[model samples]
Target: MNETNDMAVARAARLDTATLSDALDRLGIVGQCHKIKGRDPEFRMAGRAFTLLCGPASTPPGTVGDFIDDVPPGAVIVIDNGGREDATIWGDILTEIAHRRGIAGTVIDGINRDVHLCRTLGYPVFSKDHWMRTGKDRVQVERTECVVNIGGARVAPGDLMRGDPDGVVVIPRAHEEAVLAAAEEIHAAEEHIREACRGGMRLDEARRQFKYHQLQTRQ
Candidate 1:
């Protein structure tokens, strides 16, 4: 049977961004989003991506896109704002609507505002930083469903996004299976190393037994 999106998300949720990043590194995939972090340390999310691209405002700053309703439930809104720190592309109203809609989460290449609401709603938002300036006149939404960059990572529509307190990782649609399998193997090996250490084995011994040093080495 074909793997459904829900199944993919479920699998992704079982792994953190650290393990996923290692998998990506091992597979020679540049999937790790750099310098992006959760709005709240407790937040975590996983889902397919719904990408958007934004740019500096020309005549007037741009308004938030009316694309929320079209975003499927459990989808992560991936917005690329060119890593601008002066303006925010997301805020309170969007957070409330997204929470109610059951959207998996949002990840921005830049920043966001009104973060208190995000914390209150427990909505997962990963971005470079948060600010008070609005993007209305500072930035504009250029397009939707297009490939965009988040942090330093390329994010395409329908790609899998997994995030946690550590950070976010984007798994390309074509490489999801391989990335996931690699991440699972890495996670299991790490777990075994921990288990051995807890059973009175030396830390270095457990790592050697699991070949942990070579786990993330590119094949």
Candidate 2:
């Protein structure tokens, strides 16, 4: 990653999903990935998105996860599998390779298998759920570097993706700076309120002083 993009990702990593979600709401952007969460509560990932789309297996069955080798380091693999849970699009093999390659992490709109391995290797994997069933003949790669729907969020290639224990959020590359600024302001306000409360100020007074109620209101 270039210095500019790397700095952006670092800035985003400092903020959690909730703050970023509020920032998106304040900016009128639908970047929250609903119903998608980390397989392990301790998992967190922040990086540029390397997007891919998946569909039902082909007549003769096509490949699954073969494009992983092409993904660059420090990029989060965002896979949209139509939220299918009957089969898994990820497994131990993918997790091990991703960890070895220094890939940021993986986020799936559907489910994954071998989640235990993910926790063991500390390879973050966020998805709707996990199952042991293989996606070998049930799912196939449809497109790479394409616009894909993750949860209810639209993720295009190279979008900024950040996930914490709560869930994943995508910040569009075009509006990332604005979103980041908004999140930073909100974070600072909240921190100020906390400091005031620690100094014996009433919670309500602190909130009022910081305009906490208006922080997430659309601008």
Model 2 per-residue lDDT tens digits across residues 1-219: 789899999999999999999999999999999999999999999999999999999999999889989999999999999999999999999999999999999999999999889999999999999989999998999999999999899999999999999999999999999999999999999999999999999999999999999999999
What is the C-alpha local distance difference test score of candidate 1?
Answer: 0.92
Q: State residue 218's C-alpha deviation in candidate 2, in Å.
A: 0.2
Candidate number with greatest TM-score? 2
lDDT by residue (tens digit), candidate 1, 106-197: 99999999999999999999999999998887788899999999878899999999999999999998999999999999999999998998
Worst 10 residues of 2 by lDDT: 1-10
State residue 64's C-alpha deviation in candidate 1, in Å.
1.9
The backbone clash count of each candidate, in order, is 2, 0
Q: What C-alpha lDDT values do all the predictions have?
A: 0.92, 0.96
Off by over 4 Å in 1: 1-3
> What local lDDT score does residue 27 receive in model 2, on the 0 to 100 scale?
99
